[model samples]
Target: MEAELRDPIAAIGLDVEAVDLSVAGKRRMLRVAVDQDGGVTLDDVADATREVSRVLDESDVMGEQPYTLEVTSRGVDRPLTMPRHWRRNADRLVKITLVEGGEFSGRILTSTETTATLDVEGAEREVAHADVAKALVQIEFNRKRSLPEAEETEEDDA
Candidate 1:
C-alpha cells in the first residue's frame, strides 16, 4: 500500500512520513502523514489529501471498505530517526536519550549522516547517531529563532 503511494506523494514534493489504517465500527480510517524539508503547510496537506484520495479512488488497494482519509504533517512528536530528519530539524531544541543510559537536551546546530553537532548549554557537542536511542524535538512556545553565522556576521558588519 505504501509502495503504491510513495511515487505520487514524492511527485508533489512531499515525503510519505507514515500511513495508518484502523477500523472504527463500520468505516475504516486511513491517516497519511506527509512532510517536506521546510515543513508541511495547510495547502500541502490539502493537496496531499486530494492526491491520496484520487489515487485510492482509481486503485483497488482499499478493497471497497468505507474509509476516512486524513492527510497531515509529521508532527513535532515524531522522533528524529534519520539523517534527513535531523537535517530538517536543525536549529530546533531536542531531547536526546542515549543508548548507553544518559540523556541531554540541546539545540541542534548542524547534522551530518553520522553525527549531529548540538549546542548543549553554552558549548558545542558532537553526538554520533549510533549512540542515540531516541531523540524528540522539544516544543518551545517563546523561543527565539537563532540566526545563522553568516547572518550574524552581516549584522556585525552593519
Candidate 2:
C-alpha cells in the first residue's frame, strides 16, 4: 500500500510525508499525507488523491475488497524533528538542540548528507546533522511587527 502511494506521488514531484493503512470494520483505509515546495494546496491534494485512487483501481493491489483512500497535506503544527523534514524546510528559522546538551536558535542555511549549516547571530555554524537532537520551526516576530515610517523612508533612499 505504501509503495502504491509513494510511486505516484514521486512521479508527480510531490513529497510523501507519511502513508498509513488501517482496517476499520470490514474496510481498509489508506491515508497519505503529501507536501511540496511552498505547501500543498487543496487542489493539489485532490489531484493526488484522484491519481492515487486511479492507480489503485487499475492495479487492484488492495485485492478484491472495498477500501477507502484519502490524501491530504501535513498540518502546520507538524514538527520539524526529522532530518529530511528539516532539509525540506531550509531557509526557515529553527531552534535546534544538540546531542551534547546545547541549544542554538538560527535559520537553517543548508544541509548535506552529514552536516547542517545554520546562520546563528550573523555567524554561520556547521553542526553534524545527526547531532541535532531536536529541531523545531521558530516563530517569527517580524510577522507581527509593522515597519516604522523611518525604515520605509530608508528603503526608498536605497
Candidate 3:
C-alpha cells in the first residue's frame, strides 16, 4: 500500500515518510506522514490529504470498511533514519543513541551518506550512520536564530 502511494505523494513534492493503519475496536485509522526538505506546512498537509484520499477512492485498496484518514508532517519526535533526514536537520540539536551502548547530545554540523559530523561540546565528532541506533531532534524553546554571511543584509550606500 505504501509503495502504491509513494509516486502520487512524490508528484505533489512531498515524501511519504510513514504510513500506518491501526484499529480501535470497529474503526480503523490510516495515518500518513509526509515531509519535504524545508518542512511541511498546513497547506502541504491539506494537499497531501486530498491527494491520498483521491488515490484511495479511485482504488480498491481500502475496500468498503470505513476508516479515518490523517495526513500530517513527519514530526521532529521521529528518529532520524535516513541521510536526507540528517541533512535536513543540520545545525539542529539532536540526541543520539549509539548501537554500541552510549548516548550523547550534539548539534548536527553536516551529513553525508555514510556519516554525520556533529559539534559535541565544541568539538566536531564524525559518527558513522551504521553506529547510530537512534537519533531524534531536540526541541529548543529559545533557540538562537542567526543569518548566514551570505544572507546578511548591509545598509545601502546612499
* Candidate number achieving the greatest lDDT relative to the actual structure: 3
- lDDT scores of the candidates, listed in order: 0.94, 0.81, 0.95
Give lDDT tens digits, candidate 1, residues 47-118.
999999989999999997778898989999999998989999999999999999999999999999999999
| lDDT per residue as tens, model 2, 1-158 | 67777778888878788888899789888888888877888889988988888888889778988888889887645666556676777888888888889898988888776777889999999988778788778767665546799998999999
Structural similarity to truth (TM-score) of each candidate: 0.88, 0.69, 0.90
- Candidate 1: segments with Cα more than 4 A from true spot: 146-158
The CA lDDT at 128 in model 2 is 87
Candidate 3 stretches greater than 4 Å from native: 147-158
Cα lDDT over the full model 2:
0.81
Residue 16's C-alpha lDDT in candidate 2?
Answer: 81
Query: What's the count of clashing pairs in each model shown?
Result: 0, 0, 0
Worst lDDT run of 10 residues, candidate 2, spans 75-84
Best by TM-score: 3
**Ten-residue segment with the worst summed lDDT in candidate 3?**
149-158
Residue 145 miss distance in model 1 (angstroms): 4.0
